[model samples]
Target: MALITLTSDIGQQDFLVSAVKGQLLQINPSFNIIDVTHQLSPFNYPQSAYVSRNAIKNFPDFTFHIVMVNLFERKPQQLLLAFHKNQYILCADNGLLTMILEEKPEMVIGLKLDSNAIKNTLYCAQIFGKTIKDISEGKSLLTIGEPDVPIIEKNHLRALLGDNWMEGQIIFIDNFENVIVNITRDDFEQQRRGRSFRIVFKRDEVIDKISESYADVSEGEKLALFNSAGYLEIAINKGNAAGLFGLQGYLEQTQNAYLQNRLFYQTVKVFFE
Candidate 1:
């Protein structure tokens, strides 16, 4: 049986998700549908990419990973079907494909309107459902539509290098409220060069050393660690660090042109001695 994984900004509360699955079953009843997450923050590309990147690799090869977040970014007329590392990924052309994959996919094909089994559809479920049905049935990607089309590009904020300091930003806050920083462990070690450093964020909150787990600190104490994704994470032992520290995930400001200059929601600086 073919496995299909789904990740979407659409909350699990409504019947819309089920309706899409029902359509898939109507076309291919043998498809093994699994969900990565349906609680994604709406249109938050960084968060979507973060979760998608971390989760998709665990599944076996040949899984059709469907990402349904921010489907209508300025009303994209086409959807993306990409083959990368022996697996298939589908999503909107919302500049997130570049951010999520880091590199160009091995092959990419755009879904065509003619391939859509349902016409004049407004919701993503209707359009994507039909295209995915065609895909599951051995339809050639060449027959799908245009190939190697220009993908929208977007880059994440990187840790800024300084003489005795590295500036980073909060990339994501997990369900555990652990604040994931943009600084990877390799980046920190390279910049540290064997010097002592302090991670300073919000006012008066500081973590001096990296811990392996929450138990490394006492209950209710602040600790910093590198998460599974290899990014620096700050958390309070058995507590909600984001709420206590007033730190937030990266929020892209797309409405106001002037606000685009300032990108990140919260920033953390590591000062070394």
Candidate 2:
């Protein structure tokens, strides 16, 4: 029983997800299909990479993790199949593989599309489904397709520093409306260097210290903590922090500059004092 997982930006409102799943089942009825998520925001690769990276690690090794977000970033050229960290990942070659993995994979192959397959608008479903099927059927990874082609690179958001200040962008906003920043605990501490710091976001919301948990603050108060994923997160004790503070995620090539000005998405700033 081969396990396959799916994450996509295609909202659940349509039948595309079902059609894609059908393709998988048609190829192999014994496959165990798992839906990681289908509600990813459209073309938001950062969110896809963030969510998939955190969740996929928990799945059993050798499971196939397929990311179907932003498939049309360019044209539907080809699907990328890579074995990374003991698991297999199938996604578009449209720069997402670079965003999802920190380093190049031990194995990567491009599953080229046959002429008949490219005519369908949902070509991703066709190509990726077949690739997963072949692998599950004991197909040698090397025989799957060509290897070592140039994969597009995405510039991930990094915490910027200015002397005593570190400016970081929000990378994700969860269902609880907690804001996840690009700054990691290691990044924050390295920049802190023993100085006391104040994390400020929005207009005047300030958090002086990192908390162990959201419960560290009184209800309705804001708190900052290194989340289980090791990224700094801003959350209200029992409120919607993102909605209340009007903060959202921004990353490379995502939108306009992520800064404190009104023209762009707001960034979290830590001022060491």
Candidate 3:
């Protein structure tokens, strides 16, 4: 059976998510549908990219991954079908493709939609279902859609680095309220150069060392550690780190007014000595 994974911001409160699955199954019963997540924060690209990138990399080759976050960032003209590292991704033509992959895909094709038809979530799923059906039947990528089409490109979120310091944005906050930063272990090590470091956030709170686990610290004490995904995480031993610290996830400001009133509440900075 072919594996198909779904990642979306559409919550399970209504029938929309299951209805999309029904559309796919109606077209091909052999597809083994998997749900990656249905609760991604709407319009939060960095969080979606972080989750989708990690999940897609672990799936077996030739798997089809569908991302439905921010599907209508603009009027939907066509969808993107990307093949990278032997797996397939189907998503909107929005700039999210580059954000998730963090680079160009091996191949990308624009899947056309009927202009006359009402463009909605279910209609989009129907188009994706037919395309997946065609590809599984061994249809060439060029035959299914237009090749070498121009796609919207967006840069991935990266940490700000300096000679003695690194500033990382809060990308995700887990169910337990552990705050995940954009900095990876490799980034920290290279910059540290065996020097002592202090992880600082929200102005006054500081952690002088990284812990291997939450239990390394006393209950309710703040600690920093590299998460399973290799990103830096700030947590309190059996407590809510984000809520207690008043840390917020990074948000992209769309207006100039928001930029003028900028605050680094969502940032964590590390200084090496």
Best by lDDT: 3
Tell me how many clashing residue pairs each candidate has: 0, 0, 0
Off by over 4 Å in 2: 119-121, 251-260, 263-265
**TM-score list, all predictions:** 0.88, 0.92, 0.96
Estimate, for each residue in 171-224, the C-alpha lDDT of model 3 and write its tens digit: 999999999999999999999999999999988999999999999999989999
lDDT of 2 by residue, 80-167 (tens): 8989888999888887776777667778898888766553536667677778788878999889888866677675557789889999
Candidate achieving the largest TM-score:
3
lDDT of each: 0.80, 0.82, 0.92
Higher-TM-score candidate of 1 and 2: 2
* Candidate 3 positional error at 152, Å: 0.5
- Local error of candidate 1 at 112, Å? 1.0
CA-only RMSD, every prediction: 3.0, 2.2, 1.4
lDDT per residue (tens digit) for residues 1-273 in model 1: 678898888888978778767776776788789988889888777778888877788889877888888876665667888989988888888888777787778999887554444432234555566666777688887877689887777875567899899988777888888898878899999999999999888757778999999999999999999988888999999999888888887666554776554443377889999
lDDT of 2 at 132: 79
Native-to-model Cα distance after best TM-score fit, residue 2 in candidate 1, in Å: 1.5
Instruction: Evaluate candidate 3 by giving its C-alpha RMSD to the native, one decimal.
Output: 1.4
What is the lDDT, from 0 to 100, of the residue 184 in candidate 1? Answer: 88
